[model samples]
Target: MSQLRLWGHWPLFLFLSGWCAVAIFLDYLYAGIPGRKYFLLLSGLSALLLGLSFPPFGFTPLIFFGFVPLFYIQEIADRNKTSELFYVYNAFVLWNIFDTYWVANAALLPGIVAIWLNSFFMLVPWIGAQWVGRKIPSLRWWSFASFWVVFEWIHHNWEISWPWLTLGNAWSSLTSWIQWYEYTGVFGGTLWTLIMNILFFQFILNLKKQLSIRKNSRTITLILCFLIFPVLISILIDRNFLAEGKYGEICVVQPNYEPHYEKFAVPEMEQITRLGRLAEINLTKDTRFILFPETCIGDIGGPVNSARVQDDNRIITFYDFIESHFNIPIVMGLTTIKFLRDGELDSPFKRTNQAFKEPYEIANSAVILKNRLEKNIPVYNKSRLVPGAEIFPYRRLLPFLSPLVDKLGGTVAGLATQKERTVFEAGNLVIAPVICYESIYGNYMRGYIKNGAQAIFIMTNDGWWDDTPGYKQHMAFSKLRAIEFRKPVIRSANTGISCFIDARGNLGKSLGYNVHSSINQGVTFSPYLSFYAKFGDLLAYLALLFATFFVILRLFRYFF
Candidate 1:
């Protein structure tokens, strides 16, 4: 009976995965076709495919199946050199790969990202060159390399972008090459994989008599593959799950606070106790650090801003009592009270957003209350805010109209946004904090590490979108950061999918929603940094410049 049910689910699973790939393939064809009908289908499939990769199916494994159709499409389009069909085909391939990276939550996948298997994602240009190669044989190789490198560059730069498939991901896939990640960034693996694919494909093409080119293409293929193969194999062999590190006690409390509650709505005593209880499970004498999800303990506004507010001095006073009891610092999320004018008080974000005239700054932020301290210590305001909830996008066009668009109340009327990705220093630890959606912004996340962040800690409230593909995709991006920056990540979510990711993408110490309430895993600095960190997205910038040069230069040549 159980086997039958399992088989039953597999049918739908296979169907959805296959259908999504087919839909994407057709979407690609539509771009080559005149009407753009397939583009609509393409967008729809992109959305659907992204949705499928999440929870309902850890079918994250199935995402690669997309490569098959895309592969054939590129192969078929390249059949004739004169066919304009080749251009659209190249564009479509770029889009599909972009969609995959998008579905994977680009910047979020933890540790070294494994999606590098999608390294072909970067080879569309070489495939494009097969057509241009026939027409202008001299420019074939350069064109192809330029084409792919350009697309990748544009893909990573547009709209604060998603550059998850850097060649470096292939190294991440197999743990061994990953140690070198500190030096390469994910792009190193990406470059190696693309070169391998090109060599292998060329080697196979040349295996024939007439079609074969008797050139260094053969020797070059051998040498490149030989040099890269050992590195790839060594990565696998060196992947010793055997590294010794010190253990520092860390505690995480997911207060599971719902947004609807008033500032003092829940008994601060009760809510704090609830977290205290969950936290109680890991109360050790050596706890070096502790955490709570974003704004988990209270409502949007607290005592400092509220006067007649019934939920007075409760949350702060309650924490005052509890914090006084423990000597270790407790890092938590809460709404704060900041008075505005001389005699009167108003929302802290009132100046930038007049509609949200309420006085309390309902910031989704982190606060560290040192054990035995009299008051809450330094507060870290979340620099990144979600599109709809905390912030209203494209607000300049519709200013006064935003506050009225809210279904839930008490968020200080309007909204607040952070102008920068700032770092918080606690003791000897220089921590770069990413709160929620900010994690998805790779370049933005880079700013923190560039400012000297030894380690990264991301606080998220995944509870808003739970049980769906949304959560899983969000978590996967966390892995990408570990690989890109080669830093240890400590992720604490409100609901589930909380885990500690090392620089190499190795997951350490996690708590699933079904089994445990919170996780308090210790984090250590890897002392390693990535070229990406030292140089920033220079490769991506170069790609973008290349794309612009070709796009503008080519368009001008064709038109003028």
Candidate 2:
């Protein structure tokens, strides 16, 4: 009963208090740490402030100053020769706890790992920056900026890749405020944020020293430009943008199937029947396409050949409905598998005892079914899989740990993915079929656009995270994709908040969370590709380059 009271709606309170106590105890060695308790308080408060800026709260502008407190602590640590890693790591852990505590709603153990592991990854750059700065104090700011940008880059590209807290993602809710994403991508936002924080850190330092306004005039001007310039650019872009291109209307179905009790538990035929009814309500004469959320196709044994996929009663039901009722195409998520030959490219962790006669199971795919064509339906397997839930990271390297990893999350073995991005050709409209979580990757999404996807259709199942910011933030990030590529986006989620967003990131039509509904909405297609769509994460690459240069230069100087 006592334990129940402590955890009831206030588990975070208990966790935070414990976290602070642990931090205080660990800082005993640095007891003479300048800014002592104030530094610790600043760290904790800044984490809280920054965490609140993301998703649900969406106080985006606060992110600009989020790191100021830490930078202050860093400055003091540097001058006093005190270790800052312990404090920095704790601050990041607090940030992760606040921003992604909803992860616990999915699974408790993995959620704890995600929060702590992500905090550790975030701590990497700070440690590197401090180490480098100790040698070249004059170049400390540049070192800090470079380390952070490089960390964000590494997080996005590596295995166990969870870039959820990449600083730029803070503006996800404020799509209109980040129109310049077309030019630099989210890494541009990262660069902009670090620059602002550094400028403000300098401003605060100057203020402490009673420096005259004239003495710090240049830094002040820079701070003003850093704050004002991005928003100004975004506003100008938002004002002038036009979505004049024409496209067929799309109908998105939200089956509102509860993952915990209804989705997998319910009969496939019944789920399909209900989905058809939802589509029927929303289907219009102008509707050229209808989309269903991920894994709504239920489960199938192994991969059915394209020619025979419609032979399956479950898939045939939807195919027949489209043939008998409307000329429009339907796309949906499926759990599918494919057979591989003895010498074929199999999963890296394939069993040696398994016969070639036996087929391997693959999951998480999207398929397109249109007018009664004899040809096979085009299917694209999801590539950007969730770390623990979908793909066990570095399975080939750590095959022995599969059981341990799977028990912590969802899968023992990861799903297989196609090497190239697949674009579904539906008559005049070519669609990019993006699965859930795949939508978060801008560079990966650009491949579909580059392959001639006029517009994107994202199918997701957000039911696992419940009605938390997980779903809302997922939806908000889709808006950023729309702005970055200047293309209309059609999103269909398993349970709710399914929406149609225009090229300029404006909402067209949407269904609320937990609502069972569908909507037919017009979407414009653009042949126009933004700089980001063409160049892809150039800012991140440049930042990496800068970091490499600094590291090499510092090493040379240190040895000499």
Candidate 3:
């Protein structure tokens, strides 16, 4: 009986032994492969750590050392004369895919291409760093840091601008710890992350070389001090930051219109009726301004020119409804166009008809109005467009490729944008109507504040991504704007999370996601300009200057 039982379990024992042998053999194989397994592992680790630093996971502290694995790979590749570009690209692709995969929830192919394209742009800085490192090994780290910051700054200013993964945004959720953004903007946080990661990477390299324990201990102390001091300064500043003077009473309504399902398909009057009901419910005697989300009026487009806009039926009916219900100021987002005659369309952004008809320019814009208006209202067209979706990347420079770009679902002729920022007046208060996607930009916000905009009224349609962290992250990023500019924020999302954020980046009376509701809140505005608002990304400018200086120095050394 004992012999029979032993035979019965022999198969299980053999299976377990075979699995262990394969595992051991794989480890041996990895050991034999120079930098292959380690590079792949480092890439995976870097992606996971960086992904966790953003929203949903929001392990904000991980960002401080998230680049360690990639930096380590770069250093080793530099020393070995191996191809670092391949490994860098792999790491960046993984990071972009993991961090922004939610973008595929709307359009699958576009999202995949976006990830790859974003990864390609990320490689530009790494390539420069590698070349500089080969030329000046001692100053490689400094060059790399400067190059990364310069890349980030350039990323924000370009036509294909997608600054979603900008390193400083990691601290957005931790508002209390970055109150000093009023001075440095988000670029300061980016600088801090890079410095810490470099120091940590160097410490590890020193350890591998069998450095003294005392010296390593000093490095550890230095790294901790560098990390902790910023938080301490931010806290001190946050404690002292204050706001005074009431701007006015504002009523923000979230109509909960589903963008894909019913927002466009519903009858125009029905959409207005729903919005009117929400406004009626929330409208108070003290309400001075009523705010609505972007594109709330449904499938309506007209000339952005004030004289022609007044003649459009959509604008006429909207004004009629507002005047009948309330006699206060109103702000909303809409689609508008500008007609161009035969020779009037000068820019490539203006589209012409194939039948030799006239051309016109379309735009996504926000407008402000009151009950007793005679002239055209102040309309601000959205400038910071969503790449691929809202605007074709470099359409003007490569107009011949417009057909291919259109097939890929990008706008062939992008929305027309104004060269300057516009501010709308509500009695004594000036309101900046920041549309969807524009709110994420820090320097852009400062432009409005500098133009005498007292308070920010962000009108957005968050239903595009539903109730995921996509919308939540967007709402949280607005806090950075509030802190940087010292302006009260009144955000009205088409599908809820409508709320009020004070100058200190504090959330107050927020509606739940996907809910149809409105909130009546008292907003205060300050004419006070924060340091960031006055100077406008001075840190980014300094980083760009440093990067230029280093590049010139490398070129000069190579030639002379």
Candidate 4:
């Protein structure tokens, strides 16, 4: 009986032994590469880690290791002679969906296109890095970091520009850790993140090989230094920094109007009246300017002429309200139309009215209405437009896609943009009138500072994303802007998170999401420019130069 029991257990033992052998053999054959399921699982883990590093979830430290799995995947593919594109693309697609799925809440078809298309664009740098790695294996890590930074810089300047996920943005919520941004801007954070991930991945590889402690200690020490040095420097900078300049009281109003159901559905006067009521309650005697959200006045009687914005009844009502009640300058956003000149060359952005047969351009613009009479309002056309919603990218080259863009909830005709940053002046107060989607660009924001903007006023309509992390993430980005320029930021959102960020990137009292409210906050302006404001994305330019040099070398080597 004892002999029979021993034989029965032999099958289980044999099964375990066979499993271990297969696992060990696979690891040896593929240089520690896992099976297909584990590969995908690692990609998913990377996506989750990256997504959690952004707002709401805000596991910021996770960003340091977010790219480690991606490096591992690339290593596996390189060793096993398999295509890494599929797995890399899978990670990016999952990341885009995880972080910005709230975009679908605004427009479903366009939102899906934005997510998938943006993910595809993200693969450009990774693919470039992989190609360079094949040609020049020693510079693989350097090429990866350089290509990514170049990609980010391109994203900020292009027509389909979406730099929201620039790795540097992860520090927005934890501004204390990145006070050095005032000198290097966001690109520095991007480089730091890429380097740390590369080093950490290398350390993991060393451990897997069971390398001697002497060999691994240097990498371990380097990792610790990279992790702690920046934060220590940032803390030191924060401790010594002092914000100084002119002081002014500004009122930010959040009139909780649902963009889909309520904002445009209600009468234009009714919306104006609601804004006035909120401003009236919050306005103080010392308030220098009253800030309103983007497109606060819907339709504006079929897009008031940009040349004669003051003639519009909505503008007249706004001026009258200010004159009668407080006589303070009101900065608000609306749509404006400019008819093309007789000799003006036709452009893809220009549209013609079927009845009039004359070309005109529409702009998502901001204007200031003051008591003083002026022939024309100082209007700032929003320069940076949302990819699908406001402007169709490459519309000129692919006119046939216009209808597709329209069907997907995008403007068939793109909005007009101005060439330079325009700052609005009201008495002693000077502000950068940043419209929705314009606030995210740190280098672009520096233009306002260079143009002599003392404080930044951001006018936005966050209701499109409903009550989700999208609005919160948008709000958090403004904090980074505050630190980058060392200037106070005043925000007025159509539905929520209307608040103030001081020079130190500290958040003040804010109106919650979907609430009709207003708050009066005193902001101290900074006349002096920060290093980032003066120099402007030098790191990005260097990265671009390096990436270009590597590409040239790779091509030369291939031909030779």
All candidates: CA RMSD in angstroms? 8.4, 3.4, 9.0, 10.4
Off by over 4 Å in 4: 1-37, 298-300, 345-348, 355-357
The backbone clash count of each candidate, in order, is 27, 1, 0, 0
Using TM-score, give the best candidate's number. 2
Off by over 4 Å in 1: 1-175, 187-247, 254-269, 300-326, 335-362, 371-376, 388-390, 397-415, 468-470, 483-486, 526-530, 552-560
TM-score ranking from best candidate downward = 2, 4, 3, 1
Error of 3 at 277 (Å): 0.6
Q: List runs of model 2 lying over 4 Å from the truth.
A: 1-21, 24-35, 300-307, 349-357
Give the TM-score of each candidate: 0.65, 0.94, 0.89, 0.91
Pitting candidate 2 against candidate 4, the one with the higher TM-score is 2
Residue-by-residue lDDT tens digits, candidate 2, 1-560: 01111122243554567777788787765676565656778888789778987886889878878888888888777677666677778889999888776666666677777889999988888777766776787777788798898898888877798888888888877777788988888888888888888888889999999999999898899998888888999999889887766578889999987775567766787888889999999787888899999988645233444335667667777778997666778889887766556686556433222544555656688988875554667778899987887778887788897786777765665677888999998776888999998998888899999998889899998776666677888888888888888889899998747999988777789998889889998878777888998999888878888888878878977998
lDDT of 3 at 440: 87
Can you list the residue pairs that collide in candidate 4? none
Relative to the unseen true structure, what is the C-alpha lDDT of residue 160 in candidate 2, on a scale of 0 to 100?
91
Sort the predicted structures by lDDT, highest score first: 4, 2, 3, 1
lDDT of 1 by residue, 514-554 (tens): 23366667666544455777776565555556545655655
